[model samples]
Target: MEENQINELVHSFITYDYNNLSINTEELDDGKFFSIATIEKNLGKQIFTPNFEAEFKLIKAISHPEIKKI
Candidate 1:
């Protein structure tokens, strides 16, 4: 695939999947917060390589501060 095509593919996938995911937060006894992402069981299997996982983590971490405010 061309570079632009790959970029568009990744962007579309992230936007769609992120919208579909369910995020939950909890307050720990020590006054800290814990957050998690959950996917519906009926959503079907996801296929991605380790690099994609790393990229997703990076994106999530970068936006965590803003996300925590919501």
Candidate 2:
């Protein structure tokens, strides 16, 4: 995918919280990329999971088997 598309996906993932948050990305020499984000909450400490809704949407978009060219 294009760089801009990748950036947009990353932005959507990070902003899923809808709160004041920040995400940072790091690229390793091996060409792998990872992201870290800080989420501010008012409640006590709790286990949190990364939101993958946007990613799932992307996957579903590309997984359609009818649109094929051979």
Measured by lDDT, the strongest candidate is: 1
lDDT of 2 by residue, 9-29 (tens): 233332224355433345322
The parts of candidate 2 lying over 4 Å away from their true place are 1-50, 66-70
Q: Which candidate is the best by TM-score?
A: 1
Backbone collisions counted per model: 0, 0
Error of 2 at 20 (Å): 42
The C-alpha lDDT values of all candidates are: 0.40, 0.33
**Candidate 2, residue 56: CA error in Å?**
0.1
TM-score of model 1 (CA atoms): 0.30
Off by over 4 Å in 1: 1-36, 39-47, 64-70
TM-score, per-candidate, Cα-based: 0.30, 0.21
Clashing pairs in 1: none
